[model samples]
Target chain A: MTASIRQMGVITAHLIRKVAFNPAVVWLIAMPLVIIYILGITMHGLFSAEFTPVKPYRIVVALPEEAGFLVERISRAPKHFAVEEARDAQEARQAVFQRQADAAIVAADGDEPLTVIAPPGSIVLEMLAGVVQASLEQEAQQVAAAQPPVENGSREESDTGARSAGAADGALSAMPWEGVGSFEYFSIGLIVMFMAFASHSAMVHCVQDRSTGAYLRIRALGVTRAVYLGAGITSGMLLGAGFSLVMAVITWTLFRVVWGNAAAWALMTIAGAASVASLSFLLTALLPSDPKGVENAGGTVYSLLAFFGGSTVPLTIMPRWFSEIFSWLPNRKMLDGYLKIVKGAGVKEIEQELFGLAAAALIMLGLAWLVVMLLKREEV
Target chain B: MATHAAVQEARGQAAGDPSIVVEGLRKSFGKNVAVDGLSFTVHPGEIFGLLGPNGAGKSTTLSIMAGLIRPDSGDVKIGGHSVIRETQRAQRLMGVVPQGLAVYEELTAAQNLDYFAKLRGIEKKRRRQEIEEILELVGLSGVAHRKVAQYSGGMKRRLNVGIGLLGRPRVLLLDEPTVGIDPQSRRHILDSVRRLAESGMAVVYTTHYMEEVEYLCSRLAIIDRGRVIAHGPIDEVRALAGDAVVLRLPFPRGVLDEAAKVESLQNTLPMPVEVTSGELRIVLPQGSRQAPAVIEELQRHGVPLDGMRLESPNLETVFLSLTGKALRDGKAAEEGAMA
Candidate 1:
């Protein structure tokens, strides 16, 4: 057993040396970091208030008598809006056309209670319309509250209505807090995606060794099959974990991204590394002893996983069925667990995701072992 | 003092029990048989040559002895360890230098040696010393730190042999180690093999080059159709062709119309005559006594003879005598049979 371990260590060390000197590996490590940096810096403003329009939205009210109430309600809302009273409908239209007002609210003489006119595709105009509608709802609620309860209606009905209103209010207040910047969120995705793809270097090495006949030479030297396969897995794990930790440190130091619960973070990193390494081993073992074919196949498979596993897009925006399928993927679980940690979740909150990652890693490793055994039988 | 002691110990171990015993080894690939009930042995201080054509199962036999493949029946024992039952021990007693260059091209020569040495379980302190010694022995000491990719074909071949010499196994197997290289590198490799045998190690060398077998091997086995057709010392195998001398008489392009019509030449020469495109080959009993009579007889027949040459028996003729075909023609014949 000691001899086996030592042999494995030596093989792993040699593989690491070979990969470190490879020019492709240097570019593989650098490309993702540069892309993340550029994307982070460029899209950082999109998630902040600074990127919003600076000028307050100007509103013109055509009815003098009701203009005061509308202006007060608009001012009380959580948006930037300036309300001005117009002398007539003609004047309000003129103000809107002249760019004095972003939108105009006129009391209509027809069945419709109000008319809102604004420039096409104006976000501020949309916000102003929402404020007007909310004010009308508030007035109707006040009027209903002042009226006596209907004798035909039961207390359950009134209670149900009150609870529904309270639930709506709760939903409005329960929006996710802006704890992490958009760049930081996307950076995690990019980092995990790239780290997973980096396992191709190990795959390429395996294929090259076989094609070059180095594998046969080593085997003839009495290195057992188990030792060789174990060494490959260990090398891949080291690469994945090493690159991830380095990226994490850089992003944290430079971008001030928060990483919560050190223990959870460590667990997630190890699980992610094991998952990718095992997957790469299985992939390389199943492929023919051709370096180019292994590389092309590995790239295609990893890219597909990255796309469907929420590494390239947010899982929340994906359809329900797609997200369900994505949840079973190792990278998805890794990203989910990482996000939870960054959101200050404890180990207990992410225990299921971590377990899923572990299970996936074991399955992949089992498949890799079977493949190695098959290859060993066919080598001679 | 320590290095000298170590060398003496290695030499003693090599000489004490170094022998390869192959018995009834059989291997088949699906419908085709690669090695069919073949066996041989090499004793210490002996360079055993495996001479055969391209598809003669020489490599298959070497691979089985190296423990790279399992035999269908029978077994091989290296220094008293059975290759099937105790593979690790058997492998430790032997080293194999494959036909192709197996050194990692991306690594420096030193690095490649270091890797193999570690795998061989050599002590770290002695590994560096052994690597340097091997580099010097292979004449690669000047470029030990250069990557193998930058090395010439001869340099790479030398390094491949050097890697096998690490840890100094009792028996060394070289499978056509000089297949593609300049003459200088070939000489260097041949000299190295001789030196290893002199140091009391048993060596098994395989090649199709008859001259190499004649020049370096102490004893040899010629294989054909997956069987050992001949085995013994150089002189004994040569004797298999008998004491016949071959004489080639070149005539004008169309002088020799048919071999059967040469009744006069056959009556005079007391041997069979074969008429080819531009020459007539005559086989006779050894000695110059028949030469003057044959020349006089050909002159009497008005046979147009431009020039004549005489040859003695060797491995190539022995192969022809055994298989009724030349060694160089074996590949083409095999391909034709397959077709």
Candidate 2:
């Protein structure tokens, strides 16, 4: 057993050396970083705070007698809320149906104080409703404070009021700009995608070795099949980890994107590496001995996976149903885990995603083993 | 000198166990039988040659002996370990150098040797020394640090052999190790094989080049159509052509056109006369005794000879006699089938 381990170590070292000198590996490692950097610099204005939308949320106010006052109030935060005056409820509803406005508000002289009508399943409508609710609540609080204090208030009531006020303050304080910039988010995606490709290139090395007779030579040296395959996997993982480190350094130093929870990031990195390596192995094992065939097939499959996994485009811009489907992909989970780590998510919060990635890695590795076993039998 | 003596001593210690026993080996690829009921053995200090045309089951047999492939119905044992049942032990006692160059082109010669040494379970402390000795044995010590990609064909072939010699196994299988290289390198490789056998190692050398077998192999097996047609010591196998001597008489075209005249010459020549394109070949049972008479009769008939020569039998002639075709013809047929 020790001898096998030693042999695996030797093969792994040789594979690593081969990768280190390979020009293709160097290009694969540098490509994603260069592309992300260029995109970041050229599209800097798109992510700047000053380039806020002119009118993000359009709302029509139709309150009859109080329409002007409500419109003025809603329009105070013009960058976030765009208010348009309507002649009446009918006009307001017509405007929303025509898609001229995202939503409409109607003041009522009934028990419900206000009525909000918007398109079904619209995120913009949800945010508008939240904003309106918060505004109304603040107004009601001020009106209450202006009145005389009640002298017979119970001590339990006062403590409850104080706790509620503190909780509201905490929520407000936590509501700062916690979103990731487009450059940073896409950079992470590109890094994950490149790592997958780099792992595939490692499998390409395996194919080359086999074609060039190096594999036969080592096998004749008494190296077991398991040791040979184990060495390849180990080398791929090491190469992936190295690429991840370079990506992390470049992003941190250039874009100042900080990762959260070092332990979680490390775990995610390892899981991601295993997933990519095993997937590459499975794909390569399925291909025939022809190197060109393997390259073309692997390239096509990986490109399709990267596209559907949100590496080519952000899931946020994709249709909701499509993004949901993308969410099930391992590369998508890898990107999500890394993004969450960068957004200050703790280990426990991202544990399920990490588990998914780990499970995927294990399953792929198992499949890869079965494929290799079949191939070995055919070889014999 | 010290390294050579050390190798000698190591081989001497391993001499008692240096025997490769192949028993009833049979293998087939799908419907094509590559080897059929083949068996052979090599004792210590012997160079056993496997001479066959292309696709004649030489490589398949070698692969089975090296434990790289499992036979369909038989087994190979090296140093008392079955290749199929005791693979690791059997493999430890054997080394294989494939027909193709198997060294990594991106790595230096030293690095390639070092890597294989480690895989062969050589101790790290002695790896450097062993690598140096192997490089020396293959005459590649001077270019040890150069990348194999930059080396000449001979250099790479030498490195390939060096990698196979790292563990110093009792049995070594070389499959066409000198296929395409300079003559100097071929000579060096042949010399190395001779030295290895002299130092008490059993070597199985496979090649298509007949001269190599005639010069190096003490005993050989000639295989055709996945079966051994002839097997024995070199001279004994050559004697398969029998006592007939071959005489070549190149004549002018149309010199022996008359059937009656040819029959008359045949009756007087003391041998059978076979006429081919512009030449007359005579196979005599005792050429030295009847040579003068045969030449005088041919001259008397005015056969118009352009040139005349007498030859002895060799491996090529023996191969032709056994298979009824030359080795080149067999190779061409194999190529045509493959194409």
Candidate 3:
């Protein structure tokens, strides 16, 4: 018993000396900080009006005096698009098809109204078609009612419809995070990546202990396997968890990202930190003798998770099949959980994600334990 | 005279039981047998050399005895505790310096000792003192705080020996401790082993170097092919080969063949005449009485001989006489197989 305690003490001290004092820690923290700052500057520039060009796109108008009401309404679009008159429907269609104009509006009176066309799905054509259709509808309604008496009565309903439509459009266009910046989401994931790398790199020494015969020498001292592995995982979790917390602080200060409720986010970070550490340990255990195998496997897994799990794109915009597949990955669950809390989602919203992260943590830890046992059994 | 007697009494009181005992201990890795029915006892206050060339099961035997790996069958008792039934007890009683230098090179000598000392269950108060004493014992006191990676090969070997002593174990097992070491470091390690034995610790030392065994071991075993071929006191084993007349002579090549052609000299010489590297070796079951006849025959053959001398057999001769091969040759072959 005394010998086992001594063995654990020695191993723990060795782990701390090597990992906590290693020069790589400096770069692990520094690289992420540099990336976060650069991304923050870049994102800010993209959103700033000084750097972005904003102007009403020009559209071609084609109509005769017989359709004066339609022409007038189309001309009245406020700052959304400017109207340019074409010689006829033929000229307007040519302009629209040739990409010389955003869209062409062709109006016909006393016949089926003609609208010059192009395929949908083009952002420019979609916006042009919306403007033209809205103008035509307003003109037709006004002519039929011959009145502006009900503006107050229907104003609230129209406003609500416009807001809902705007939200749906934003969800389709942006990466996840409820129309907030991608930097906020990417910064969090990058920070988590740093923690994972740092922890895995540090814990690789445990594998070295085996290859170098330090582990065998210590085992002869009668140390229990638990204390030895416990010290290792403990060291990894502390380093990974502490690094992630620092990243959260940096994210909040530099990017103005809302990390949601402080208490809830802290809880999620703790769970995520444990899961990342266990994953690293499990990966190190499963890999062959080479240390690079661990690095390759861990890197490949992290990259795949980040790319597919709505961390790179909004989940709602993903194809239906991909949503089903990526939803099973831990990264998606973790990001969703983090996003929910950051977006002020309540406990009810994040419970499933929290459980999923926990389950992942359990599976990884269980596999790590199994590997340690197999190694110990081989010693005997 | 009375004071000398009192010192002797005090020394005997400090001495412990035999540090190691093995009975019918056997082990194998898959189909290849490593240690086959090996049995030996190492008494306290002696450097017991388990000598072999290579693949002679020296390392496998040591591993089983040291509690690092379990024997496939049989019993290993360390300081009166059964290794299999009471592993912790066995471990606490013995410290093993493995075939490789297993200390973490990144850690300082003091830190390494303190770390292992804690694992050996030394109290915190005594741990620092033990580290200091061990460092001094190994002559590493001046550089205890320096990183081990920066240390010389000799310094690292000394620290490795020091690590094995941290527990103050009743028994110490050193597996090829001086392999690849400089002469100065090897001598220092031999001196340390002598000192440890003088202080009443039973040590099981394994090495392929025949001279190391001759210098330090009080009792020894010469193993071959996973079995002990010859084992006893150094002098007794040497005597087993009887008297060998070794003649260092600047003699012509093929002198032995030429000498053997003489009809009058053939029956009168020693058991056999062998030539190696310009030297003639004649092993006589009796003594060197046939030297004159051998000299005359060499002269008759027109073989110019210089620096003629005769000496009795040593361990090399004993090993050769018993196994019909040199100890070192066997070790070389084994190492080749391992490589």
Candidate 4:
């Protein structure tokens, strides 16, 4: 076991030298930082405009003339309330449907519960509902103070308060890139992107090793095939992780983009490295004789991955299905993790992305193992 | 020609049990048979040559003996360890210098040797000294720290050989280590290999260049179509061709193939006709007076000829006399198939 580990370590170090000494490594580090800077400086203005504080909420209330007191109280409320009276329930519903208002509130007699009408995922919906709920509760308090309580509500008051809080939490989490600057998003996004491209560079090394017979020579030294493969994967991870570090440091220095939570970033970086490195290892194993597929199509493949994963463009700007598709891509998961890390999310908060990346890496690793086995069948 | 005294010295050194023993090795890739029932043995301190063309299964045989691949049947034993069952144990006893330039171009020559030394489990304190010794031995001590990518072809080839010698294994397997390099580099490599054998290390040198084997190896095995057709002491193998003179003519591929296929020219000559990719070899009995007639017939057939040369009986002629095909015919077929 000691010998095996020594062999793996030596070979891994050997491969690392092969990658780190290549003059191309300089370009690997510089190109991504250049892109991140250009993309960050040029596009920050456009994205910052979207993240600016939203306008006042417009709520249309449908209630009887006797209930003018509730509407009057809501209009004077804080939290940027902009309430408009409706002729009837139809007009109130029409206001929300026509997008003229953020939400609508309908009511009947005093004992009847209020109904909220708002579009799904509307950022103002939760706050507006909270305002209307607070008004009703205040009115009920006044009535309760005047007379004896006849019956309790169907659901517990605790439950209603909890649901209101939970709804606010749900809406906030559902929104992507809140409190995230365009510079930070592009910083992490481009880093994650270039991290994957580093695998291609690593693949070129593997191809050279194979073409030049270095791999065969090492195998002849009583080293196991697994050790050689492990070395390739280990070196690949190092190369990719190194790029992200240098690029991250450059962006932080130049663009003032802070990558938060060292432990979280480390895990994501490792996971991203594993995801891409294992994937590159898989291609090398799969194409024993011909790595042309990877050599020829690697740029296009990574670009597609970046485009679909919201690295090239934000998923929020794309269709909703893009976000759904992002969940399946390891790159997208890495981008997600980086975004969350920049937002000060701890390891626990980004564990989902980590799990996703880990699973993808493992699957690629498993597939690579199977390919190595198949290659072993040739006994060469 | 090997001196009788040198052969006697080699014979004395080979008195003990052989260091490498390959028996009945057979392997096939799908429908193509790479090695078929091949057997050979090399004693310690002997520079044994496995002479063959590019596709004569020399590399595959060496690969199997080195435990890099498994033979379909039979096995190779290195220092008494079975290559098939005890592969790692067998492999540790041998150092392999592959046909290609296997040293890492991105690494310095010293770094390449150091990497292999560490991988071979050499002690850290001893590794640095050993690397320097190897670099000196391969004639690369002056540029030990320079990256191999900047190295000349010969320098790279020497590093390739240097890496194999780091572990000081009992046996060395060199698969065409001097295929394409300058005469200076080839001389250096051959001298290094000869010195390795003289130091009591058993060596198996595989190559199609018969002259290298003649100059370096004491004993040789001539293989064709994955089988050894001739093997013994160099003198005995050379004697197989008798006193026949070999005539070689170089031509374009198209002309060579047409010359090989011309039935009238073949039937009229009454001698074996062999065509390689762009060369032809014909063995003739001295005083037969068939050379002028053969050329005239070829001219009559309008077959283009680049030039012609007369050669003495060596492994090239012996191989043609035995297999009735040029060494490179098999090589070309194999390359075409691979392509």
What are the lDDT figures for the candidates, one per model? Answer: 0.73, 0.73, 0.68, 0.76
Candidate 2 chain B lDDT trough over 10 residues, lowest sum: B330-339
- Correct interface contacts retained, every candidate: 0.51, 0.67, 0.51, 0.75
RMSD of 1: 11.1
By DockQ, who's the top model here?
Answer: 4
Isolated chain B TM-score per model: 0.78, 0.77, 0.78, 0.87
Clashing pairs in 2: none
Give the alpha carbon lDDT tens digit for every residue of B101-133 in model 2: 888898899988888888898898889898989
CA-based DockQ, model 2: 0.43
List, residue by residue over A31-150, the lDDT tens digit for candidate 1. 766776776676564344444456667878775453356667876643477778888767887787787888776653333245566653244543554466556566666657653211
TM-score of 1: 0.71
Give the per-residue lDDT digits (tens) of candidate 2, residues A182-263.
Answer: 6777688788888877667667777777776677778877887778888888888888877888888877887787877899
The sequence of per-residue lDDT tens digits that candidate 4 reaches over residues A1-380 is 88889998887776777677777778877887788778777667435634322456787888766566667876785455678888877788778778798777665446644566665433455455455555555666777665412112321123112123123333445545655777888888888888877766676566666666776778878788777778778888988898888888988998898889999999999999999998888777777655466665567778888888888786544433447756779998898888888877999999999999999999989998898788768664
Off by over 4 Å in 1: A41-180, A313-320, A378-380, B1-18, B53-56, B224-230, B235-339
TM value for model 3: 0.70
Per-residue lDDT tens digits of candidate 4, residues B93-202? Answer: 88989887888776789878888888888998899888888899999999999989899888888888989898788899998887667788889999999988877788
Off by over 4 Å in 3: A1-10, A39-176, A250-262, A287-324, A345-349, A372-376, B1-17, B53-57, B224-226, B236-339
